[model samples]
Target: MSQHHAPRQYLNWLASLGLLLLLGLGVELLLQQYGLRQQQAEQQRLLAHANEVRAVLLGELNATLHLATGLASYIPARQGRIDTAELEPWLQGLFQQGRYIRNIGLAPDNRIDFLYPLSGNEAALGLYYPDLPKQWPTIQRIIASAQPRLDGPLQLVQGGRGLIYRVPVFLADQRYWGLISTVIDFDRLFAEVEAVARQRGLAIALLPLDAAQQLALTSTPDTELHLPVFLAGANWQLQARLLNPQPPLLRGLRLVGWGLALAVSALIGMALHSQQRKTSLLLALSQSQRDFLQAFELAPQGMALLDAQGRLLAVNQALCRLLQQSPTQLLQRSVMQLCVPAEREQLQVRLATLRFGHNDSWFLQLLDGQQQQIAVECSAAILGQLGSASEVRILHVQDMRERLRLQRLQSEFTASVSHELRTPLTAIAGALGLVNGGALGEVPAAMRELLQIAQANSQRLQELINDLLDMEKLLAGKMRFEAREQPLWSLLQEAVLHNQPYAAQHQVQLQLLGPPCQVAVTVDGQRLAQVLANLLSNAAKFSPPGSSVEVAAVVQGGHVRVSVRDQGPGIGENFRARIFSKFTQADASDCRQKGGTGLGLAISKELIERMHGRIGFDSVEGQGSTFWFELPISVTKPQDAST
Candidate 1:
């Protein structure tokens, strides 16, 4: 038994060794990552400095090239070729013109045919060939292609101090010809950069490619540049420059690196500590989520996510309860699919507003699993995506079936009342017509007056019935709306004329207010006229004898408001709220005296409402009531007014 225990001791030793190996591996990984990060940081710093100098280098080359190109337009009278004699004098005069145009020349037929520096000697004009291989290839290409070709220093012959730029010539006819070229002196070209850097206490030098190697182009007696240079061509070079290479002790990277290492070590220890406690925290969070999800699913209203296209993304139990559809079934289903076909178009159009990142909303009647219609109000809002393909949205849905059902029932009752009155109305009308025709001979004078009264009351009743029917039609969306722009004042006058007889009968003075402003509003003329007549007639009826009834129209803030006010006892505050309700007359007793069916106000309200106008009453008890409605005025100037 004592010998067998040796295996267990060996296993304990192996466990300790594994732990040590893991610790070593982690430290090595951290140090390796630290080194990698340092290298990356240094590279990034170098890149930043490089970018700053890039513009300066390219600008110098461009300036030299522009000076040479300026020669093309100088010889306007000549053909598509440069006059060497004139070009030499012209270029020599412009020697110190730009940053780097040190010399200018013309090359044609694969040879340096003209050098501005040697312009004075006619023998050297075309005879002294650069004969350099680099010059010939570009020269030939320029002649063949009829385009400008730039050549370089390419180790300037006989130790010249500049870069050369060559450009092809073309006359007014755009014909191709020989090349005009220039060489920019490097030392003077970059003198400004060096002066600025030195003035700012920065060590600076013009580094260039000399004999295919990076060398200082300027004569810097003592100062040195540690900045790196990049060569783009035999002569062109790019460099990254910085103010200071060695930062001060506090600013030095050695201390910063040590500080960062300590901070990282502390972070690692804290991270380990946090990791040890993560199990409990995660468990708590998971449990909380479980509780939240349970409550969310049990909410009374439907919940869903929608894309910008109104397609469903997600749903909850409440949605299932409302639509009687599972989350899986609802996924990818468009709002159109849930609503009736007729309603789908409207919903789709409204939802399209979400494309502008605005919230869209509509109430819709959807067919449930049993094919029964259920009303719901859905509001959608766009939550724009991270980038480009960014058109996602969210949807909030609430069941409105009960509210809509109540409204339908109310409409049905109104329709029923209108239908019920028709039979009595017909009988009364027929009897009154028979009496008017004198079928019943020799009636008393007072009796005749009574019969006339009866006939009038009966007609008033018929008009109310018709108004109720129209209201129901409009509510059911069975009414057609025709909108057009008509002359505002003319329409108002016509309405006044139509209701003038009624005003006379009521012994009321009706008048229109405001100037003849040429403002037109979009509306259904027939419907709006009917609305005006109803209001004016009511005002005339309510007015005291010899009192005035005002029917005024005004344009304000791009809206047309038409108001009818009666100079009679105004509506009491208590009755104002229900005055527009169907069959609810504020002055119930006055209904008999005024000979009204009480549906006029309510119907007028609905009519104006459908035309996107608003109706309201401002009243003060015992004084007067001003019944007003407003419609959007057409601000589109008449075609003839175009400027």
Candidate 2:
């Protein structure tokens, strides 16, 4: 090879190495950011999972405490001896309901007097609570503090690790009356948490703070995360570790970087060989520019490049055709010059407000070469970084003429159809009512039922027409709401009373739960009553004979939750998605049997929403369903009304 060729080859090699090094550094930085983000995400996930487990454990513990506290309140304190034989039935039933409780013991004077479900806890029977040296301190604390205490994950007398919850019983005047100890199996309690950790490929350990190091239970792990577990006054540590740690994100990044570097090196070698043969680099540069121009011109959308000062830099063929102007005529002109005179100021204001790398859009009228105005949606985006001299902006224009025209046509059609149906529907309903009321003449006995049926059908048809009109008005934002602050209890009672006649027809009673309270909410009284009536009518219709429909008003945070609960065949999953949609029904056969326009819920939803409230339901296929709505509480407090 010639000396000149050798020097060029060496220079190419050095350039390729520098490019590879830069690529490596870039990949490393990206991988560092990715690793940091992954660590944060992992920590968040661990905390969420740990809290979930904590909640479950707390729920179980609270249930036992509730039962024990309730039982303690029931048992009377006596001077001599207390008979626990008669209490066995209740204790046994309570013990059966617990998920992890192995035994429940009632100790009077710190000595076990009664223990239920003694099969696996026989050794714990008739034992003195304070005699157990290992757990005596925890028990003594419960007695001294007169509060419930949690003990163990310790060695139980019956063998195996279990937690004991001790609730100190107290009588009148702070007299201590024995204690109730609910023993929960540690292994069973953590079964769900362990299973979840296993599924997530995490190693977990539970270490009691009071226990020796040798007693710690763990899944063999690598990198560990420690979280504190505090339950019922017992402090414990929950350690989550990775069983099979993953290689850092950097590993894959490095692999990709090396592969790209190799490809780039090969490309550099090829380019160098081409350079030696074809030494005119200027021709290659010109060819690349031509390729870019071809791509820009062939794009479907109009493209206009504007400098930072908003003067046009380049215009593509599409843009030139859109503007009906030649490249020579439009070159170096202000982009704002294309807009009509009235829109130029607005365009200048929008451009001034735009930040680099952000987009802004507005509607404007543009003038063609012939000076005719055309409607267009203009979206502008600033390109490149702030304070860069090379930075420019791009404008994308779309013609909105067709879309606006179609929207106008749709609105006109809906309004006209609704108006046309209203007059005829009112006439039909009035005529049917007159005929059914015998204003036309006395009807024969055989035709009476048929007349009644016709009247009902006509009423249903009228309801459908009304529903359609209301829906249209709601969608068009033409409906008016007169809202006021009213007594929530009064509203609930009125709705219940109104629905009583309907409920009686179905032999279903409407019972209101909870005492009357002084709670007020701002709402359109008539609209809210209508919503409640619709819900009640549904509940009564679906309930079986002698079944009671429960109406409740619960005070939730910032709102009052009103619900209508019915014991009926609950909603099917298939119908749930469109439950609030117009013409939706749980069963198509229901329209015939239950007699509805299938628009009650849809209309009710609209009415509630107009009053700024939310409507929803909870259902189990076989159990029952509860349809509810919540309205924001009124700022004013009202006087309590008697039930």
Top of the candidates by lDDT: 2
In candidate 2, how many Å is residue 559 off? 10
Lowest summed lDDT across 10 adjacent residues in model 2 is found at 213-222
Q: Taking the tens digit of each residue's C-alpha lDDT, what string does model 1 give over 144-167?
A: 666565554445653545555556
- Per residue, candidate 2 scores C-alpha lDDT tens digits across 1-643 of 6989999999999998888777767666666787988877666665566556556656766776666556666555443245677677877777677667788888888888677787878898888967788778777778899888788787788888888888888766677778888888888877866786776666677775544433543322225655666778887877776655555564533475665776568679999989876766768867876896687677666777777777877778877887899988887899889999988999998877888768888898988799988788888887753233466777777777788788768867867886887788778778878877889898789988987888778777767767677777777788878898778898888889989998999999999887875788888888788788889999999888999999998888888889899999999999999999988778788335777768789989999988888999999998889999988888776657563
Quote the lDDT for 150 in model 1.
52
Return the lDDT, model 2, position 328. 85
Q: Residue 433's C-alpha lDDT in candidate 1?
A: 75
